[model samples]
Target: MASHRKPRGRSAGIRTTPAVGITTAALTSVALLSQSAQAAPAAPTAPSAPVEPSLDEVKKKVDDLYHQAGVATQRYNSAKEKTEKQRKKVDRLLDGVARRADKLNEARQELGSFAAAQYRTGAASETATMMLANDPQGYFDQNHLADRLTSRQKKAVDEYQAEQASATKQRTKAAKSLKTLSESRDDLRTSKRTVQRKLGEARALLSELTAEEKARLAAIERKKEREAKRKAEELAREQAAEAERKRKAEEAAQKEREKEREKERGGGQGSSGPDTGSGPGPGAEPGSGATKAAKVIGFAEAQIGKPYVWGATGPDSYDCSGLTQDAWKAAGISLPRTTWDQVKVGTTVKTADAAPGDLVFFYDDISHVGIYIGDGKMIHAPKPGANVRVESIYYMPIHSVVRPA
Candidate 1:
């Protein structure tokens, strides 16, 4: 009965034990396990299958290169367009000069023919014809009309002379113009060559960068754009705030002036009131520095119609410094001819202390200048894509302020 009980108890223990039990002996002998007891050798690793690049990877690279090529093509097209435009302008100028030259030559030839005809039918020839006439009385009567013939011949000669002179002058001018046009054409050709070379370089460079790199660069560019836009909006807000402050200041000054006038009128019956001239009051006078500055502002206003010139100092066209010099000169004040020289001609003033007609310098190297026109507005000959015009002070970089002598 004890043997039967032992067998049952062992059976019961076996039944109670779970199937997943790692005995100490099994764990110790894992490294030396029998082949049948071990796992199936990781299924032979499938030989690693030497993977060629995927279709998607090739497509991605191709797509990146294609986009780069497109960008390069677009740049090429833009350069071609610009070159063509400039070439067209040069052609037009040359054609106009040639046409004027041809017209002048034709006019000269026609006038020459008229002069020759008049000379052939003139008084001397007519007198010779009348002397040889069969009727002597008819000859005398014709001779009496010699004075009219002489007058007519003189008038024709004078007109021909004037026309020849004009034609010669026009021809000379046209020749000069053609020379200049030829130079411009050469320049355009050089520009076209340069653009084509740059386009080739761009295309070559496009072949080098990989798809992943392109994506990474694009991400960076987008981030830069967002940052730039944020900065621009911030600058714009600051400008708006400055403008509001100036408007309030002007209003306050106007109110003060009005109140002062009212008090003078109401408080004095016998006193003659302040002299109010439509012209500059006692605050402005010739030779006065501040008054001269006001006149400079007036001079700039007068030249609102003048065209912008890149490097001109002018009776006609002007760049930034050119316009400033001309405006100040018009107001009987002399300033330097260049922006750099002009920068040194005035007393340095803070931006807040800058008044109307103060010279405003701009840019990292001070490449631009403008005359402050009060209330945060300034007049300048702006950059290449712009003209001599009035703009907000906040539109460009403001380096410093200078008050003129």
Candidate 2:
């Protein structure tokens, strides 16, 4: 009130601003911040596209899948073989069970006839008779007719019971064997499907590559083949050298033994007919094994261009183990249907001691098998696309060598 009256510029010590002025300033500041925020740009985001694998990586992955497929294929082949064998066994068991059932029926008919004859004679049932007779000996002695009838009836009942029991046991065994055969058949189908699926995946992956990539992959394979050939040649040379060294060492040992024998004979010359020692003579012909080997090699060579079919054992197409099994079969030796079983059936030999017709297994799983054909070479039906052909044994990593013949 005092300031309203008259002081020009210095009316009161403190002056208060209007509320509308403070609100207007705050609103203006908020409007300016909103406008600035609207005008500012947003931060950029990173890319979201996925990176593709290189051709080499794809090839490697496909190769791994192919190898896995090969393993599954071998498993399928093994299961198929087992299923076939089990089916045969089950058939034989069923036949035996049928025969036993027939015998049981005959025995039961004989027992029934005896029971009927006893009933016609006004005799009690065998069970009732046995229960009623406190002294069986006295009862039979008093009635010789009953004694003869009961003795025959008792023998019939015993035979019938034994036959029934035997038939039942055989039926139970046949049922279990049939169940196992069914399971093996199912397993075979599963393994087959697994192999097919893996191979399909590998094929699809390979099909996705460009022509240039395909060419590049082919070149890589060629290089590998060349390297394998070089290694095979070197191995052949080393084997020859080793064989020569062994021959010289053996010759020297034989001469030393001959010298010892001569000295024992008072320095007189011994007869030089031939060294009748453990080893073969210098001019001895190759053994029958060599003939069998030749036959195996011949059979394998005859099937040089056949297609490779998984789980196949035939004169047409063959799998890795199938080709080997059939080849040995041509030489009059029977081999199991799969490599896993075939490997166990034969005598294991060293790689250096491997002869023609020897089964050379490859990979750590022993999924692949080929017939060794000398000169560090083997005949094999390689993977799906490959034909039965001769290649270096060292083309793949060797697991072991087995001689089936």
Candidate 3:
């Protein structure tokens, strides 16, 4: 049995074969290497196609950023004004504090002099002096002298203390105001820098586009401008038509009224009434509102090619508000420096009622301003990189219209 049993246990399956074992091990190792080589990830493939924005999308994004910058510019202007005002107030307060401090020093000196006089006087306790006095008259005299000296010294001390306290309070107030002024100036600088950065980013974005893309964007802008101009023209036509209709109706009504009066007076020829022009004619006086409006419009037109610079109120360049303010200034009208303040200086009127030289504020914050130049057109410093030019009033969201003169 031992000889015939297919090799017991471990020896049964074991091939006492070293060549097969070596061959199997080598094959397994080769298979593993091949598997690993195949299993390793392949090198990364080429990148996917990039998504490009449409021309309109890019324009809108850039316009929104510019609008934000405009808002920041106005905030910067406001902060600057406030900082200046606070600085003046602080200076005044400091001056007052110096005067008060001088008064306090003088009061202290007076008090010290009174104390020295008291010390020099060989004064004793009132009760002790009264007990030591030999006669009633001497005691009475000593009591009166002590009372008078004490009263004068107390008064001087009280005045010095009061003055010192007042001076201290004023100094504290002035210090706090100075700190606030510093903070406001810092905020103004931050706002200005933020506006500059936003404009820079917008410029960079515009520059990054391909030549074809740039052409497309320009074409889009031109198309928008054309559409806006057409719409404005249409509105002007409608308004003119309405005005003509109203004038004809009014004239007819006047004629009818005159006819009734004539019948009551037994019939007589009526002299032609004054010309029913909407405004003063060519013969208008030089100082009339229409004349002033013409002057303002003329000044604005002369600045057509000027650059748009934030916070500028100059002859060579201007901001939106600055242009309007200075143009009105040229017409002998003084407008506030900022759109927010300028808006409050004039009578508010409807957009339809707006006349040439009327100030048109735009955006919810009233950050942008332009002078209406009749015919639904306005002259404005559009934005950074854009020159002052005539454009349709409908180009921006209308906040309000004001007659500055």
In order, the Cα lDDT scores of the candidates are 0.63, 0.83, 0.83
Candidate 2: tens digits of C-alpha lDDT, residues 130-215? 32466544554566534455576667656766786789899999999999998998999899899999999999998998999999
Worst 10 residues of 3 by lDDT: 123-132
Per-residue accuracy of model 3 over 164-207 as CA lDDT, tens digit each:
77898999999999999999999999999989988998998898
Clashes of 3: 0
Steric collisions counted per model = 0, 0, 0
TM-score of model 2 relative to the true fold? 0.77
Candidate 2, residue 384: lDDT? 85
Of models 1 and 3, which has the larger lDDT? 3
What candidate 1 gets wrong by more than 4 Å, as runs, is: 1-282
Name the candidate, 1 or 2, with the larger TM-score value: 2
TM-score of 3: 0.73
Candidate order by decreasing TM-score: 2, 3, 1
lDDT of 2: 0.83
In the range 224-339, model 1's lDDT, one tens digit per residue, is 55664555456456656877998799778777776687687786565475533347745477677678878899888877657765445666766677789889997777886656
Q: For every candidate structure, what is the RMSD over all alpha carbons to the true structure, in angstroms?
A: 21.8, 6.3, 7.9
